[model samples]
Target: MAGPEVTVVIPTVGRPSLAAALAAIGPGPEVIVVDDRRDARTPLPVPDGVRVLATGGRGPAAARNAGWRAATTPWVVFLDDDVVPAPGWAGALARDLGGLPGHVAGSQGRIRVPLPPGRPPTDEERNTAGLATARWATADMAYRRRALEAVGGFDERFPRAYREDSDLALRVRRAGFTLVRGERVTVHPVRDDGFWASLRRQRGNADDALMRRLHGPGWRAASGAPPGRLSRHVLTTLCGLFAAALTAMGAHRRRAGRAAARIAGLAWLALTAEFAWARIAPGPRTPGEILRMAVTSVLIPPAACAYRLGAEVALRTGGAR
Candidate 1:
């Protein structure tokens, strides 16, 4: 019996790794590359026979919707541009989908993130490695086209490449379809996004707020996401804000303000130190790594809280996108 027809849909921001991803896919099934770069003045160079669609930088969720919607096959596989499929992965994927029942809406490919052999992995490397066990990661996920249509595809409200996959998977499962692990594997390489990468990632906290609002506060448990330090972050942020406010108020009521400031300042210091140490303890203890952790830890709390608060406010005001 013939395997189900599959089309690989890759949403890209013109990363250099996109070419490698396409090459690793090796030209069997129909491939659609969604060009999601904000600037479309320069044409993306893709190999012959690979179709390209433009989303004008609406983000991964929108780009994916564009790619899968354009596909005519029964199966639409979504692959992140930074991943490399294992050799002969096309055949493995076919076999994975061949005997699946109609109720099986999706098949997830195992992801491997290669860390350095010598010495402990850095914080960034360890974070990247988490994708290996991330539930329903789109790094290499395949969904039956009909299931996608039934659920109305990905929610474009998820503007970034975070939480969108989990949200979709939860929705698909709730719609009465099952998802399973597949035999095929893909490699997700660790990226060097510079020193402030961790700080920048706090933007996802806003998306998390949206997840809670849409799927309820139990969304994390329902979606298999880890119980994150959001409560701790909120506490840290409160401490920081109280310390600053008390310090500023010291001009009028010197004695009372000084005592309040001292208490809040100590709480903020302890929280920040603890957060930094948690990250530093697990990885390489190089001075540079320590400094990055210390600095980002101080900022991440406030940044995360601000994002979540902003998203909540947006949701309340009908301004969330």
Candidate 2:
């Protein structure tokens, strides 16, 4: 019988790193780059023998769906546009999938995140490092085309680069398919996404809400994610809002409001300080890092709670009514 053939699918938003990613793959195992830029008027510049598809700015889930559905090979591998495949990756991928039994639906590649040398990593670097042990991160994962078809590919409702892979893995497993770790490795370089990246990442809490609605409260354990701090965030956010409300109302001569405001204000400050310390404790404690953590820590709880609340309300109301 002929050996199993594989196609590589990378979803991109026109990042400059796509060029290096393509170069590292080096011309084996048919490659498809999905351009997810919503307003692209021109095609992405790719070398000959590489195919590019457009998903019109849909998120990674939709982009990957477009790529895999267009593939004819039995196996479709999903790679992030910023990751560099290890040398001889094509052959390693072949080896990883060559003898998989029918019940085995997917193979995951090991991920390595390179941090700065000679010092502990910054908070942002540490966040990126989490991908190294992330379960079923599509940064470097392969799935049998039939298996993908069976589970209906990624859930596009995720709308962001978080939690979709875990959701898919859960569904595939529930469908009686087994996913295994493979020897193939990929390097996920930590790109500096500016100072507010951590705060910005709180947007993923919305997806977590969707995950909860779809998979129930045990979704975190089932998806291999560490226990979350949503409950704490909710409390922190409530305290902050209550503090502000009471303080504002106190200006109208409400004696009880003044005392309650002090208590809520103290609670908010204590929670925010603890959250900041937790992040700063394990990171490089330079002045800049400390400032970033302190500022973002105060802001993250409210942002997370807002996103989660918005998503939950939307889910419960069918998002329209």
The candidate that achieves the highest TM-score relative to the unseen native structure: 1
Q: Which pairs of residues have clashing backbones in candidate 1?
A: none
Instruction: Return model 1's CA RMSD, one decimal.
Output: 1.6
lDDT per residue for candidate 2 within 28-126, as digits (tens), equals 688999999998788788888998999898899999999999999999999999999989787788888998999999999999999999888988899
Q: Write the per-residue lDDT of candidate 1 for residues 1-321, one digit (tens) a residue.
A: 148899999999999999999999874689999999999789888999999999999999999999999999999999999999999899899999998999999999999999988778888999899999888899999999999999999999999999999999999999999999999989999987999999999999999988988899899988888888889998988988898887676632687777778888899899999999999998889999999999999999999988999988989999544
Worst ten in a row by lDDT for model 2? 246-255
Top lDDT hit: 1
| RMSD (CA, Å), each prediction | 1.6, 1.9
